[model samples]
Structure formats: C-alpha cells, structure tokens
Target: MKDRVLDLVFLVGVLFKGLDGLAELVTGVLLLFVTPAKLHQAAGAATAGERAEDPHDLIANLIVHGVAHLQHGSIVFAALYLLVHGVVKLAIVIALLIGSRGIYPWAMGALGAFLIFQVYELVTNPSIAVAILTVFDAIIIWLTWREWRRGRELRTTWRGTVAWVFRRRVAT
Candidate 1:
C-alpha cells in the first residue's frame, strides 16, 4: 500500500514536471520571435482594469515588467535557459517514471540545487509562483531520496537471495 502511494505520488510529480517542461519549451521558442515591446503591450492590455484583481495578476505584472526593459541579449539568454531547463527536467521525469535506479541520485541532486536557487529567488523577489515551485522541488527531492533507498534495499535483498541459493546448490 505504501509502495502504491509512493508510486502514485512519483507519477504525479513526473506528469506535472513534464507538462511544465513543455510549457517552458514553448514559451522559450515564442520569446525568440516576439519583440519585447509587443510582449509588454500585449501583457499590459491583457492585465488592464478589472483583471488587476485576479489571482494571477502578479504573474501578469511580472511579465509586463520583465519585457518592459528587455534587451536582445537578455532575450537570447532567457530563451536558452528555458530550453535547457525544460529539456533537463523532461529527461528527469522520463527517467523517474521508468524507474531508472541510476537516475535517482541525479534527480535528487538537481532538484535540491534548484530548490536552493528558488529559495534565494523567493527571498530576493518573493513571488508566489517561486514559493510554490520551491516547495514542489523540495518534495521531489525527498521522494527521490526515499525511492533510492527503497531501490537499494531491494538490490541488497536480491543479492542475498541469489547468494543463498548459490550456497544451497553447492551444498546439495
């Protein structure tokens, strides 16, 4: 029952991250072709008036602010960063879903590192989205660690069983 629950939780994480990666990838590509002025204008228009009271108004404000002073170099850097982050996260999601034992540590490390950065970002910029992402990353790191420990135990048990069988056969 615990295993099932863990598997379900892990699967949810994978799916969530996979979708996030896809969104980031798409956004990255879009950033390449859209001018900052156009982006700011569109975002401003979308967030104008009554929309300011919406829950996601902060996100819209952030986007408008970001593109308001955008540079070409910054656009390229942001695009590259989003693309790499999306690709790496998607790969991790696939590996975790497939139960790749070797990937557990790497996943934990990557998520842990990202969590640390998110924490810093939260402190410096203090966005609700960043806070949510930090929590999610922390959860993933814990899950990966637990899964890795489980894998280690299973491997040990399998080795012991194999060794016992071999000894029994030799004595027979």
Candidate 2:
C-alpha cells in the first residue's frame, strides 16, 4: 500500500511536470509573437472588465502592474527562458517515463534547479502560483530522491541475490 501510494505520488508529480512544460511551451510561443506595447494593451483589455467590477481585484491589478513593467527585450528573454526550460523538462519527463535508471539523477538536478528558482520567485514576488509551484516542486524533489534510492536498493538486492547462483556449487 505504501508503495502504491508512493507510485501514485510519483505519477502525479510527473504529470504536473508535463503540464508545467506544456504551459511554458505555449507561453513562450505566445511571447515570441508579442511586443510589450501589444501585451500591455491586451492585458488592459482582458482585465478591464474585472477591474471595473472590483477595483481592488488582486489578480487583475497584478496582471496590469506586471504588464506595465514589460520592456521591449523582456519578452524575448522570457520567451527564450521558458522555451529552454520547457524543452528540458519535457525531455526529462519522457526519459523518466521510459524508465531510464541513469536519468534519475539528471531529473533531480534539473528539478532542483527549477525549485530553487521558484523559491526565489516566491520570496521576491509572493504570488500564489509561485508559492504553489514551489511547494509542489519541493514535494516532487523529495519523491524523486526516494525513487532513486529505492531503485538503487532494488538493484543492489537483486545483484546480491543473483551472485551466489552464478558460482559453481560444490557437490556434497
């Protein structure tokens, strides 16, 4: 039962990683086609109704505020960042799902790096999304470490169990 629960958690974590990758990929693609002026206009248009309904709407205000700070080159940099992260994360997810023993470490390293970034974002920006992402990434990192350790133990035990069978048994 414990194994099953752990497996489920791993599955959820992997699925979340895939989702995150897809989101980044899509956002990056959109960013590639957007200019700061156009993005700001769109943000204003999108949030106008919400802002009108509630002038203090946190989400609407945040979107407007964030868009206001976008510079000409910011979109390009962000697009590149998201695109690279998306591709790497998707590759890691695919490798992990294919059951590559060697990918576990790589996956952990990539995820740990992202988690650190997310933690920094959470601290500096303090958004709900960043906070949730930070927590989930932390959980996934722990689960990944557990998974890697478990794999090593299984391999070790199997090797130990099979070693005696390979040796010649003396006739008694």
The candidate scoring highest on TM-score is 2
Q: In angstroms, how far off is 28's CA in candidate 2?
A: 0.9
lDDT of each: 0.74, 0.80
Instruction: Write candidate 2's Cα lDDT for 1-172 as tens digits.
Output: 4654565577667878888898998999999999999999999999999999999999999899999999979889999989989998898888776667788888889989998888888878788878887888888888778878877432343344345334424422
TM-scores vs. true structure, each candidate: 0.72, 0.79
Clashing pairs in 1: none
Clashing pairs in 2: none
Name model 2 segments beyond 4 Å from true.
Answer: 123-125, 152-172
Give the best candidate by lDDT.
2
lDDT of 1 by residue, 57-136 (tens): 76677667777898878888888878877887888877765656898788788778778878988999898889989988
**What lDDT does candidate 2 reach at residue 156?**
41
